[model samples]
Target chain A: MAGETVTLSSLVTWLSRFRDLVTENRNYLTELDSAIGDADHGANMARGMAAVMEKVGASPATTADELFKSVGMTLVTSVGGASGPLYGTFFLRFGMTAGAVSEFDGAALSAALRAGLGGVVARGKPELGDKTMFDAMSPALEAFDASVASGGSPAAAAAAAYDAAVVGRDATTPLVARKGRASYLGERSAGHLDPGATSTAFLFQALAESLAQG
Target chain B: MKKLINSPDHVLADALVGVELAHPELKVDHTNRIIYRGEPTKPGKVALISGGGSGHEPLHGGFVGFGMLDAACAGEVFTSPTPDQMQEATKVADSGAGVLHIVKNYTGDVMNFEMAAEMAEAETGVRVESVVTNDDVAVEDSTWTAGRRGVGVTVLLEKIVGAAAEEGRDLAAVASLARTVNAQGRSMGMALTSCTVPSAGKPTFELPDDMMEMGVGIHGEPGRHRVPLAPAADIAQQLVEPILHDLDFSGAPTIVMLNGMGGTPLIELYLMYGEVAKILQKSGIQVARSLVGNYITSLDMAGCSVTVLRADDELLRLWDAPVNTAGLRWGV
Candidate 1:
């Protein structure tokens, strides 16, 4: 967290905060999913994050690649829904992009997050208006990279990402979904907050909070 | 919410134990959450594996036996099984003739199976072929979204394809037959009420007392739209017409199933079947074989679905073939 570089500890702390955020909002996420999905989003997120944390806790990972690889694989194996593979691939890609490094400066973080988002897009085949996690995460990464390019500190970049993600999540309310289970609703999908987008917002919020400590 | 279980979180795990105790004919792999026939896949027989969320009893799991699936993975209620579970089943079920994964067309199920197919092949050198069944006519736009939710036709496909696999068809033939069964079937479902997932502990959606949700997916997802509750005959018309319209069922031997959603009684299901049968008769669709009752269901959703598979002699033969399984028992 010193200077602009996020140490391995900070990344783990970020993951821990993300886990806590998902666990706390599990019911809320499920409620959102119930409106448009299977009503398991909350339960799925809670269980998946809990599984990720368990893997993280057991024989703690010393490097970014080792950390998020387990995080991704754990989620992919423990969580059965679309979120499992999508989020799992995100972390797996992030870890792969991060290589064996223990610290990520602002630019490096942007590249890592960008790669994670690319993985999600590749896995889900989602478009911007698809009312998926991509809707939130895509914009958040853009804001993160934009702030970083403007010479913003890591904390400021993360804050920008979090703010953009919230805006992106809220913008989904009026959208008619074109993908996922919600898309099965067609017209009825409009006016409902996408559960995936909501969770993705939480992911960014956790990032911003972790970086705020710096 | 008032489900018979030790706890919400342990519903799947606890139910696996019950599945083991109740069915000695099948073997339950508790750690992997798979249900297999008492014996391993017969050597050289192409194994057929299918699974999905647990609430739909006798489906994937109960169908595992001599002439049906070799193994079935069980996910938490209303959730697709993980890839690792599917991979485990794939590895165990393979006997050098390869394995066929009969996946329901849900996004989660498709993705998980896709991953399992790749992983199983990569890790164990087991060849895996998959057939994703999307027989529900409910989701009108197949080119878009996740397409139709796989429903009752899955039962029909499992029986038909499983028989073919048991007959020692290669993976290519078994997988192709599975696809043919999927293409030839169409289904429509309606729900009188929304079912609650044990962990969610509440109705997934609310339907007014006088209204009914039509075209419902198996998970209690909101269907095409809600309509006023009607008589059994009218409800049958609503369910059967769309299926008939979606495909040409006339002049073909069709397998019809009037499947109940979990909560409806046998008496009501038979009554609904009567109405459904009448419509098919009037429409000139010959029913070569018929199955009624809760073959596939949403837990506690007081409703029914009708699956019509336009079949030929081959499918009918497989359908009639001796099969021994917990959910289905006949010629065997």
Candidate 2:
């Protein structure tokens, strides 16, 4: 399944699942944000993902890259915050990495996820444990890489990535943020999960569910 | 929770509508959420644009007039506007002369404005230069963490740069003045109460009446520390001392502003300013000019900020220059 062909419907389905996950957990995400940020992360992500689902569902693209690119541009335009740019850049870069492919298997998916992580790093500059979205996303990508290299199916690889993301998200609760608005809280930022990381975990969970359903 | 509004959700839209109604001199762009002078963009004058979340009133909006901002983009309450909104504003404000962006150094605001500038330059060849104000001394930036938050000095930078632009100074000169104003000014704020975002329908943070948050940001983000409530004079000292220590205002004539954070009253701001002035006098600093009012604000946050700009003859002259807007009007 090295060069498996994926369809635009798969992309739309994944984003729909992601949006639902965010909507269901909006309160929990906002609570996480309340501890360190302005407490709007959960709501902002939910709104963004809901908009993503609506836009993608309305006019389904044929190619995987085109589908992801639409999601990326929509997020960038509609989100209107730091998360919009960061997350939007992730999808945009991921689509570019996919190179207009119709489908790819576990290894190719891992490469695309790696490319998305790189885009986030380039934009946010968060390190391994900066208590940002990168904390969760970086590890999730690594877990996907490991699982794919070990010949795990895409579903199994996504499940591993989701687990890694949850761990990384919880790790932020003890670590003080060194980036974004939470950094202004200094020592006070501890004892709260980074909002970005929490939402990132949701993204991975959505991916896992989408893979299983597909 | 109490506000003078048709509905909490409609505050920004209503306010923009009211602006158009009350001031026929200003042109309100309902679609893009920008406020500009009624007259078209001046042919050769450098355009000045500043904006952020909607809660910081009189700023970005009230500052748009003959001698202040050419345009102001209004975002949702406590949320920065998108790059598209800012790009549209830049295009509208730019004639043949380049445009200058007076941006607050918040992460979202900076990123959006930078994106707008990039887009504006690419689309229309408008030489867009930006000056970011980061005068808040609450946050420490070591090898770790984002740098200090931009706070009150944004108002001062807009006024000075706007004056320069009104004087028909070239874009380069206006940009230079804007940077100088940013470098010379320092501000610190404290909150007696947290602000409630209209959309959130609750306070951003809760504070007991017995305590106050020192070094509070305009957006209701918690500050450097929380301390027991003190007298207005003492609060003034706490806010001014840090700013004075961070920068040298000695031997330099300073323009001081004791700005009320929305919910704060003018009487309280004046009282705070009196104490701030006494401290500045004791420090052997000369105050050339001073303003005390709710110039920049958070949404109904009961607090005030102290901004001290080291003014030269040039800045002083510009400060004296006429400015006619909804929030501030003098010598017009």
Candidate 3:
């Protein structure tokens, strides 16, 4: 398990898978957002991810850092909402933490995830239970780290993170929003699933499915 | 669903064509979607830039010209502009004195502008300062939210602060004036109907014919509450009271703007302004200046918002300065 490593190809596959997931669930995310947000999360994310896919597909970025940085820049320039900066900063920090390495062992992956999450927290300033992407992202990182510490494979750790993300995403329902446009709803923000947490869950699920295929 | 648009996807691009054609004084960059003053920023003068989603006509973009914003970044309908667009605009708008970013208090706009400011400074070594306007008193400033929104005050702030920048004030003084304007102003908006985002191709929310949303944001987000529709007098009271209660506007001479929310007619806006003016007079708030029209708006949302900026001699002087822009113009 300690010797199992994820290659740059897996990273590319992970992003492609996430892009498809976002495309498939575009309307669903928008519908969730309509309840409490500006009702463009799905459309914005889909557009941003499509641009990211195109850029990453064209670039010959063999290193993990180069790949993630390209993805980050694409999202930052393409997506024009909270999702743009939050996800863009996440990947930028992830790339910076992963450095020029072309591959990531379980330990390296855990550290990169932590770094990405830290970037999100710094950019968005969301506290726990704020019903943001942080809700899902925070738990997913913890699960990934716990699985890696238990000497699991990258695929196993991703699967663990995906499961935790799902739970965290679902828990956003009935919780009031405290950040982003959804917070404008105040008490009405409850009884609705957070669009950001839902999309973040898809991100981890895509990661799990992509790594497992390898 | 029935809009004059060629297609949902082409709305912004097609509209920019009209914007450029209509306003020859502006330079529209179609690729980056930034609107700049045809005339570059004067040397040693602070430049001002403001932007947000595109549905709000004449806001950040239409206001870019002499004595106003030097540049404006345009995003997709009801979405914040991307950082690259802001970075480019920042670089181009900067004079030797530096640049000031006038941002609305939406989360996306704030984050993107912050990133752009940082990038512009690091990459190009241009000095950048920013002031975020969050004068909407309707949204309670609580721990769970991003605080009050930058509503009608943003329009007034841009004009007043833009005048200050035009006066050759340095970046710090201009930025401070912008913040002071924001602190001295308050706004409240209401909506008779929800707006349709071009991409969404439907109303953001459904409103009953008999009910109206109060405390509405510019993006068609639902307001604080919905109640049975009332007369213009009652509606004006609803809008003005929240603003007045939030701040004591009685003593100072206040600048008032009755801004239309895109779909509302000028006649209705004027009528709303009349009602609002009556209320202010009764409350002993002296109106130093008044503007009634759509300056900031939601896309095709039928409503009006009231903005009151408490003014002293200096603010009034700045407000009286010549301004030449598509959305607002006086003494040009």
Candidates, DockQ: 0.75, 0.55, 0.76
Of candidate 1 chain A, the 10-residue stretch with the lowest lDDT total is A1-10
- Per-residue CA lDDT of candidate 3, range B35-70, in tens? 999988999999998889888888989899898899
How big is the positional error of residue B240 in model 1, measured in Å on the Cα after superposition? 0.9
Error of 2 at A62 (Å): 1.6
Q: How does model 1 fare in lDDT?
A: 0.90
Q: What are the runs in model 2 whose C-alpha is more than 4 Å off?
A: A1-6, B1-11
* Candidate 3 positional error at B306, Å: 0.7
In order of DockQ, best first, we have 3, 1, 2
Model 3 residue B324 CA deviation in Å: 0.8
* Strongest candidate by TM-score: 1
lDDT of 1 by residue, A61-171 (tens): 888899989998998888887888889889999999998988889988988898899888887899989888899999999999899999999989999999999999999
Instruction: Give the higher-DockQ candidate: 1 or 3.
Output: 3
Range of the 10 consecutive residues with the lowest summed lDDT in candidate 1 chain B:
B140-149
Candidate 3 per-residue C-alpha lDDT over A1-214 given as tens digits, one digit per residue, 9 for 90 to 100:
3237888888888899999999999888988887788878888999999999999878779787888898898999999889999999999999999999998899998899899999999999998899999999999999998999998999999999999999999999989888998887788889999999999999999899888987
What's the TM-score, to 2 decimals, of chain B in model 3? 0.99
User: What is the Cα-based lDDT of residue B65 in candidate 3?
Assistant: 89
Candidate 3 residue pairs that clash:
none
Q: Which residue pairs in candidate 2 have backbone atoms (N, alpha carbon, C) closer than 3 angstroms, thus clashing?
A: A6-A103
lDDT of 3 at B133: 95
